[model samples]
Target: MRDPAPRAVTSICRALAEQIERGLLTAGSQLPAERKLSEVFDTTRITLREALGQLESQGLIYREERRGWFVSPARVAYNPLVRTHFHAMVAEQGRVPATEVLSARLMPASADICELLQLPGLSSVYQIRRARRIDGRLVLYVEHYLNPAYFPGILAFDLTRSLTELYASEYDIRYGRVRFDMVPTALHNEAATALKVAVGGPALRIVRVNRDQHGRLIDCDMEFWRHDALHVSVEVPD
Candidate 1:
């Protein structure tokens, strides 16, 4: 927009947001380049940019690394303690779910990991890194740390699938008590890089510690999710 008035800026932002809400723009669709959008909207680049910033802040759009802006996906309402796997939950929502196994290795447990799992002595822990996508969009990356003693020779198994299923079949393990600690944060380092967001983009960190029927820690899961990708809700029975 070359000489747009203030009203035009507000209108443009609102119009785009409505398009997103109505699925006219569709989730994960890239917006036209700045020059093209400016031309189409009959506005100056400055005005168009202002509207884009508004959309970004409202969680209606997001920018990717080396990529242009795209409409943000509808937030998934996550049941933090659900027994259902990610794939099932996603399918029930009419979205395709996929998981990529980044890496799996056994490493000497750090003091932090040991503390979180209540390990009394230094021991090795099996760590697996996974990135989960819904509708072909990368939304969450999680690192799972497990006590190697409970999973002897675990590296030989196919780890790309659900770990919960593996536990039930392999060791007859079932979840007992679980603890969750979550916080809003800015993505950084590998989490930001894997998620295709900037280093400082807003994100959420969910830490889950799961125990088995014997009251022994099964694993500690650290999950990093795109801020706009999930709307977390928990149902508690008092």
Candidate 2:
């Protein structure tokens, strides 16, 4: 005793999945209009949506805010314990990576930032905002807060490049200790808009503080990522 409509739903899902698996529908490709798809399958909109939902849960599909569904691209594998920087890490995974500097300015450190970096009240710092994309999809937005006392005139340099390389070449500072805090949360405001996700959509927030060999905190980075676009993996040392 099975519902006849459910059988049709499964069949429709199978057909669409075949198209995706066979490359008829490429990754990041938007689906046809819902009404058009419904007519093609001769099914109700609710039925079609249920099938699409299943695909989404299976990681075969995803949706953007105010945008329709699309086939999901490969997820980036990230190892938090490693010292690799963002641009190099993404490239090592065989994906094209790009970064854009959104904003950069010298600002007075907040109380929380001062405590994190062990600075006095109202200490001046450099705040840099950037976005990272892989395969033309924005995956993460980051805010970098650095202690400007360590690098005088850092603002004169290009902020779009890797800070790790810059630090090694100019300041001879390499990471000695790195601390990471990760949490699952909802994206909001500028971060949401940058990643093209809804304000309340699921995301992974990562806060990282880096220290130099002298045990001095150099900078801290806050990263907001699309949950579906990244898979983090790390092996802790003894």
Candidate 3:
């Protein structure tokens, strides 16, 4: 025994998907009001929501807090092996990149941070929190933990600029021997609040441990990205 409601839901989902694919609903454009969509589809709000949820899971749509669903932009391609930093890579793709420093201060390293940075117990590190946007859409929330020994008076610089360039110019340090770890996760409260999404919404987490040209650990970054905002691509040579 099967309910007929799912058929309607599927129909609505397919119709809307086709419209999006045909560019009737442009990227970043909000969908019609639920009431209007329900009247147009002749379906209940529950079914409409189900279809929208399906679309969201497919990364074709996204919902903002207190705002209706909008068509998602095409994902940005990311190559972890590339040495280019965020600003450069985004500009190369013809997309605008913006970063806001949420907080920056000297903080005592936690146990995990100590282990990652190879710092002695009770050592202090410069902790910087940031929110990043692409084309005016909040896309990433990140925390940077930098070994304070390598950078003094770094807080005085424009924190919104590229830290990679800052490190080279200010500290004569170039990144070398970087490592990355990625996983799918639900956004935590802090990241969700910064990105303006639900606390438990799906996200992609990437952890990066970086070393300087002298082979000294310099920093580690934890990044939480909207699951719909990126496409990771790698090219390997034989």
Candidate 4:
């Protein structure tokens, strides 16, 4: 006879999915404990976990490392062609945005960073690491590598604010051109830790290279976002 565990998993998944869709489980609200949920479903913990995993893959729920699962909020629409910054875009979508600076220092540019920023070998760059939250949920971890020659004393400024505004206000330079590269990836150590997700969980990686109005490469940002947190959208003019 074929196994019945798959059926149990499917049943539980459908039940939970209905609850979420009907708003019985609100967005960002933590699910009940695993043991409680398993008992409620009258199934083995393994089966319940499988069901939860399926929901997670479907973007209806998410898990944080050491923390229980939560109902996922609606995805934020992301338009790469827009020139707006992170805070602005997120706010425009009616979500509260907050950023925390993790680290900032002047460091020797790695070969990869140098290539992205068009810097010579052995040049130093200012590196800034940050975590961004939408409506109090951590969603993105980013690292920014800036060509030091362009911004002197940048470390003295507040790093938690939008770098785009900072560049224009302090340095009188604005972003003119940008390139984007994105791929689905497994969360690495640092990004996973920062986002409080399990190592190797699914993530979306976006690498952005920016040039100033003078056509000089100014910075590059590597952003790792929760895969469920974004909906990519773009409009092309005829």
Candidate 5:
């Protein structure tokens, strides 16, 4: 027999969650009033309110004082200290991961790229642009710049594969340390298009500079993600 007390609330929450996940209830869509939801689920008003509260805590819905509830946009979390690749992170969350390679080429380093990589003027750099997805939803736009000498034939490698793993297995290039800076930003046209958000949508811009075991700059990467899609966490040891 099903447990009766929480069943009704859970059912309502699950139905709403499924609709949100399947895009039937889109972001910013206003949910029905509590009475309507209770009637729809054949439950009491208190139970319906509990279900809405649960969804709100999961970042799936928001309640306004007088406006009822609206769908909360999706979000993702990023950890700078983790050494794993993007694919691994998404996989660990049981979300599908995919990448669209926008551009990859060998080019002379721009001044900023040269400075970040500590390369001399005119040194070759492998520049790659990719759009990342989670469960078929566009989420991140990334641009990576690498020292060509440190990662030859990188452009030819399967980019969807883990770059860190490829470097470790093939060239013994491993990240010994990483530095990250984050800032709030508004999505630009290209980033908005890649991330499937409107222009001026809130974003978290992360810039990472990774160094190899030898203390040489290995890669400089910039990532832009929808602000609603991610959470960041750090655990401290006692």
Candidate 6:
């Protein structure tokens, strides 16, 4: 059967979301001007703005005072409580997952990072920054810190794939526990650029620390999820 037409602004937002997921619109791509969009959708400007507002709330688009809207990048949803990788999560949702490795390097751990990983000062660590996509939409910017001693040659792996899976196969490093801290914050300049949002747009700042089977720290990761493109749900059993 054919799908039903979207009913309201919420439905319009979902249609735009589908466009992003299918690659009809790409990250950093500017959306049509509001008036033009209204004409294209055969709706009034008010309804168009309402749809756009919903997209803005979801972090899929951002507005400038006079410049108009643009597509925001995608992000990966990392749930520390679940023992699954980002790729697995996307796959389970029937979405295509891809990674763009922005940079990977070995650097001295920062004081705070060292403390989080329980490593000594001057210890080298692998810093990896990636832009994650789901079904071709930019959804997240991920920054991962790994203790160099534990995951040696980490920089040599194909980062377009899952780091957690690579660690499991190559080094027998399997995570047994994880902890998370989630906070709501406004996007900063760099984060705004990566997520294709205006400065001060809503974002979810997530901090995660993972540990191996022996309870040793494996990695510390920071992720920024555009508020518009993600929804968090909790299911409780009675």
Candidate 1 minimal-lDDT segment of 10 residues: 1-10
Q: How many Å off is the CA of 30 in candidate 2? A: 2.3
What's the true lDDT of residue 161 in model 1? Answer: 76
Candidate 3 ranges with C-alpha deviation above 4 Å: 1-3
Model 4 misplaced regions, further than 4 Å: 1-3
* Tens digits of per-residue lDDT for model 2, 131-185: 9998888889999999987888877888778999888888888878998999988
lDDT, model 1:
0.87
Which residue pairs show collisions in model 1? 1-43, 1-44, 2-43, 2-44
Look at candidate 3 and give me any clashing residue pairs: none
Candidate 2 TM-score, C-alpha based: 0.84
Write candidate 5's Cα lDDT for 5-54 as tens digits.
Answer: 49988898899999999999998788887888777788888778888878
Candidate 4 structure, TM-score to reference: 0.97
Q: Estimate candidate 2's alpha-carbon lDDT, on a 0 to 1 scale.
A: 0.86
Whole-model lDDT values for every prediction = 0.87, 0.86, 0.94, 0.94, 0.81, 0.79
Better of 1 and 6 by lDDT: 1
Residue 59, model 4, lDDT: 94
Cα displacement (angstroms), candidate 1, residue 234, comes to 2.2
> What TM-score does each of the candidates earn?
0.89, 0.84, 0.96, 0.97, 0.70, 0.73
Span of ten consecutive residues with least summed lDDT in model 5: 61-70
**Model 3, span 7-120: residue lDDT tens:** 988998899999999999999999988899988888888988998889999999998998888999999999998899888988899999999999999999999999999999
Could you tell me how far off, in angstroms, the CA of residue 213 lies in candidate 4 after the best superposition? 0.8
Q: Where is the poorest 10-residue window by lDDT in model 6?
A: 1-10
Residues 38-94 of candidate 4: C-alpha lDDT, one tens digit per residue: 888888888889999999999999998788999999999999999899999999999
lDDT for residue 177 in candidate 5, whole number 0-100: 84
Give the per-residue Cα lDDT of candidate 5 at 105. Answer: 95
TM-score for candidate 3, please give it: 0.96
Q: How far does residue 161 in candidate 3 sit from its true spot (Å)? A: 0.4
